[model samples]
Target: MKKNLFVFLLFSCFLTHSQTIRKYSNEFMNIGVDAAAMGMSNAAVANTNDVNACYWNPAGLIGLEDSQAALMHASYFANIAQYDYVAFAKPIDDESAWGMSLIRFGVDDILNTTQLIDANGTIDYNRISKFSTADYGMTFSYARKLKLPGFQYGVNTKVIRRIIGNFASSWGFGFDVGFQFEKNDWHFGLMLRDITTTYNVWNINEDEFNSIKGAVAGQNQDLPQSTEITLPKAQLGLSKKFEFHNETSLLASGNLNMQFSKTNDIFATDVVSIDPALGFEYGYTDLVFLRAGVGNFQTVTQIDNSKKIGFQPNIGLGFKYRGIQVDYALTDLGNQSAALYSNIFSLKVDLSIFR
Candidate 1:
């Protein structure tokens, strides 16, 4: 009990410290969807299966008996449509596995805009513009079971691209390394993602920064507009499974994730926060499951200072039949009602090629 309390306190401190480094950017690009099933459960990380291990904890592949593949898609915010993921994993002999994954988020039908000028030498109202934001990544991963007692490891490399209308675009690369340990039904996992200082090289084509005619004489000089933006994330989690009966089990887990970056842009300052979460899953005969979870950062990290803590909550449900699974999740961002509610739904088919 004392050890558990100590771990909890340590995790809390880490969350507190994480806030100082929070920033927001092309956040949609970095969002990860390991499996539709897990999405319904609020993106829990510590408890995962072989198919999703590639994204959440590669060490999970060590427990699989054969090769498997999965695909998932989500509709975000109802307006920013089209988010999807696909992944596959196959064993290397008996102690290792190799995997591949892809993620994409895109939007369409944005109103294009252009600047307008009046005859009086003054700028008129800006024209309504349509634009799009899209980002995608491809990842290669490998995981191996260690001969040492209770240890497993995995690593992943990803190439990323971000497109913002016709005026700007960027590309970058990042990596993730992870470790997991299991003894009996208890599990521990850690993942350090975007560990390398990754940056996107932006090529800007518009003269949006041009100074006005009356601007300071020396300040009007055109400046170099190209820049790079960086992203970094770290996560640690633990879980334990409890057997309630011959055909039923319950899983409870906790997670802490921290992100660091000099700026939200390839070059600007951003907000930071430490998000803590708790989740549970109940299963019967390994065929059907139900799950729910809640998570929130400290009140100081919230975007709106007027809101109180304990407002955001997440819920999800999933079902499986033979090799097919379907999942759905809903997230509530308290008091931020103007923003569309966050929801995700996914369907996956798992194929076992060898057995």
Candidate 2:
């Protein structure tokens, strides 16, 4: 029971005591939003279709053609941490569509050294104080268009909020499902994020957790019951598009994602594990874009033990007019930072172009 503050967002979480499942729960919603799908590295689950697909593959939000809105922001490490996103989508007459999204990852002020020691251990540096640690996600989406022709489907409903300022807080719920299919031109997708497992329910502040209790020594500090579990994951995608006569075009995508247990990826085993990704985009007449991607394929273990095969690469740029769209990403999430602006940018709007 020694977490009385000064946690720097606990390196973005992943600490629990019981309540099963979990493997990276929530993970900032897998850190992919716009920026042309993290410059493609996320492989867009069959190449997304706008308004950030409510967070990728909400059946591509039926590929939105009109009402839409989006925004994004990013920063990490050097800036301490902050990420934000927003979205909106619409279309309901021709088969269906709807969307909403919001996300925020944070770390602010920090430093709350548990009253800096006192009651006989005197060291009070003015009893430092100031804190924040946040994570929030809200989503709602729906999509339809399936009478079997080119198929489509989508769903999501998620709400999670976490905080660590007063010492602890949590609330969660989740669901996701998606599917897409296209024929000749080729594209296929599927996603299943929390499918049904997510749960968080935590609340602790026992007097701010008794200011770190015994601070260790007898080592029996109890008072943990975090209860967080999130499991169920999958993604499979494929994409294709190529044309090269007058305006040029190219699109290629791939993904395997998945998670169930064993992992060092590279297709590991034990139950399920796979991680593969690739993405690309290049267009011209549709109004300029270029992108690239590669994905995380960890397997490191060096120093002389040898075993390498790490990956993650991305690049992106996009622009469109008449309906306005802008995107950019140099990519880095999990690897944390490369500094300088911390990259990633996004914006999309086509709210009927203001009617």
Candidate 3:
């Protein structure tokens, strides 16, 4: 019992310290959606020109040749988490388009360890409860080409909701704006996420606090809290396509992401966070694709009193026939073990097929 108590104290301390590095709520909105984007290290903002563009850069939606729909699913953290995404886009005319997208991320069958006790005055393993936590978002977007010909701009209005079983929940609203310029074989894109600094209002009622107070007796407890602000973020992308032979081309893309807001979480002392990623896709006659990327760089303290940047790699394969596209991607989780990776699959349908 003493050993267990000691371990619990240590874990509590770690949690307190880790908050410094963590950011505000609805982080799932930042996770990349489609397999092609993840397979390419999320560097497709400038190069995305399909239905999925609504999730990346809405400006890219103007490039969709027809009404399109895309669906994506992935298992993260060894299947402990599930992510699903869907998007639809329809070009209104020659120079304008509108779209909508839905995103869902969840963890199911989580053991509610706080209620593990039984009335017999002893721990009852079977008495432990299970619950699921889910995050969801819906976005509507509009994009139009500029009179400048190669330049385009877009905006997205987002509604976000998060739920933790029947205990607590939050509602948030935000907006995104993006610009894209495409000429010849080169593309440039910029996106401002949560441009208005999304605000999430959490409602933690008395009943919710009472439900867990018994298990959290001491250890620096605080009253139920409400409200958190998500800071704005920026992303810049540049991509170029090099055509070699009969419709075969190689596309190289790079992205730079930065956070401008400060977090109460103390994980890092820096006022801003910057991450860069690079990706490449080789397309064969626009039928098959081979993709790879490297990014997720972070400085880590080494055992030898040295600091080094860590890199995570990703690879993906894709096939497109007629109006149907299938894509698969595997992202390295930096664990070195092959089994410890993110698996993603995506399917896209071009509604023009019906025409």
- Could you tell me every candidate's TM-score relative to the true structure? 0.75, 0.35, 0.87
Q: Which RMSD does model 1 reach against the true structure?
A: 11.0
Ranking by TM-score: 3, 1, 2
Model 3 scores worst on lDDT over the 10 consecutive residues at 13-22
Better of 1 and 2 by TM-score: 1
Q: By lDDT, is 1 or 3 better? A: 3
**Better model by TM-score, 2 or 3?**
3
lDDT of 3 by residue, 218-249 (tens): 64245434666677888999999898968888
lDDT by residue (78-197, candidate 1, tens digit) is 656788888888788777888888888877665432333344646554643456667778788888888888888888887877665664566767777888888887788888876774
Residue-wise lDDT of candidate 2 within 184-283, one digit each (tens)? Answer: 9999999999888889788777776555555433542556667878888899999998999988899999899989899787788899999898988898
